[model samples]
Target: MKTILELSMKSVTLAVVLTAGAALAGCSEINGVMNDLQTMTTSNLPEQGIAQPTNKNAVSLKTDLVGLVGWFENSCGFDPVFYTEGTKENQVQKRFDTFQESFMAKQYKTDGSYTAYVKPDYRSKLPANYREAVKNISVVEDSTGVHYYVDFNNATYRGYDLSRLELFYQPESDYVYDTLYFKNANFVDLKSVFKTTRDDLDELRGGEFDAKSRSVMCYLGL
Candidate 1:
């Protein structure tokens, strides 16, 4: 439950600033980054008038056990290479090791789902009561188990598509229902910004840059 401002101040502030200063001076992508910082942290504005009713479709318990397990194992694991370049391997590994300890799924529920808790080790980085206030993430699998229905526990900034908002999955089908309404994210703009910055860095460093990072979805045990 850490606030958006706090996360920016603690995690990406310096790095982003330095990158902007070094590569693209006075580019608008910096504004997009700032906009994302502000928008992604807070809850979406409430809907107008009466709230929409939950779907009446029956909840399905039939799950693809193997697919679900495989997804979870992959999602919760983190790789150091994604966090930094070759020179910072040890630093990335240390940080990722700590992240894995807390994020890795530990228990299989009797209800045929997987859950994970935020470990005490992350207490200092997270809100004081996050361990309790933030509930375990529940992963509900589809019939084929190729897809999943997962809860975000009201997370701040859930990646490019705002994937962590309150979402409903039809137990019998792959229908995903998102409660929040947001403008279509300009991923093209975001991607262009990243690529531009990356290209500049590569040119400056004689093409030594490596764009390798692990998928956050896979690291979350999927």
Candidate 2:
């Protein structure tokens, strides 16, 4: 699975950059940009974490999901810092490395691979009109751990409706293990879907920055 960074880098065009620049004018501060990124990614979602829980509460799950989605959409996806005007590449790389190390599970620190915890084609399955396609969310807790069930709208996998996502939350470590469940009992281990390496990030940074690429930086408020 290609990282969001890889996909966005390859697909960003000059026209898109220009349009985004005009649309995002006055979003100069990095914090504001981050907030905009989150809003852009999750604006269409319904209310989440409405169900009761025993171990981890609804608030914790909601916060974690929001943070995870925001990080995935912006920093992992477009990486505005990489395109920030006058910022050195090394500085951006260091920040990216630090963020990844802190956000990801400790296993990734030693294994040298970042687990996305979602299907490789999950984004592709989302309806074009929907920003965050999550239809509804319910949280529950049993003796094992806290569980979050996330339902999707108009999505299917292997001829079966892609109905639910089960997130097993570990309270001690504050990590989530996710699984995608289909209507027919078929499921995918989201943890096994994609693994990103530092080498991949390095290769992304090594790409040639052409005139259009520089224009993106300028348009993103430099």
Candidate 3:
């Protein structure tokens, strides 16, 4: 009886030791993950990856639009809006507000006479179809008219602009892609798209008082 009691106590103590080791190992792994998350910052990223807003005080029309286009065209991987399907009015307003901010007029030239260039997706240097007219499209004599196109068919592929003017990123349905963003596009291959250089695309922003939008436009090849 004495020998059996001693053997059982030894087994119990071993079990307790094993449990303590596992708890320690788990705490160590969790501590390592916490450290990694703390190190991520904008300073480590490139200019395009940088999210410096032009104005910190107020959100205006042009900046909002340009910002929308910039994210769709330039900062694709960075924007959290890779997924959009619900047609809530608030969602539409959010997209409109974004497009209202990011595009600039220096890259987007407009005349008293305006024509709308629409593309559903950002394929390459050019769009599949460049339709110059749309009924009830906004054409301002002083303000250049903003054209709208829909990329309702294909919205899930890379190198595709994925921005429509009057619509969000819909899986299926008539969508409107805008020229506001496309008009200011500068094309480069996958390698050089985000490459850092003196003449990098980040220099495209301006405070000269120009129109900006969140629409994704095709490349004009600067």
lDDT string, candidate 1, 1-222, tens digits: 322233535556676766676565655677777788568534332233212222222111111111111211221213323345554444434453443344333356898765433344443443232232233333444453322222333222212222232223443354433222112344223222221111222321111111232112221211
Ranking by lDDT: 2, 1, 3
Residue-level lDDT of model 2, residues 83-198, one tens digit each, is 56675543444443442233223224465643333333434443333324456655566666666566655443322345554556555554544454444433322223222223
In the range 99-179, model 3's lDDT, one tens digit per residue, is 333221212346443233333322332221222111122222223223333332212113333233442222123332333
Per candidate, the number of residue pairs that clash is 11, 0, 35
Q: Is candidate 1 or candidate 2 better by TM-score?
A: 2
For TM-score, candidate 1 versus 3, the one ahead is: 1
Please, what is the TM-score per model? Answer: 0.26, 0.27, 0.19
- Candidate 1 matches the true fold with a TM-score of 0.26
Winner of 1 and 2 under lDDT: 2
* lDDT score, candidate 1, position 15: 61
Which segments of candidate 2 are over 4 A away from where they belong?
1-133, 157-160, 185-222
Candidate 2 colliding pairs: none
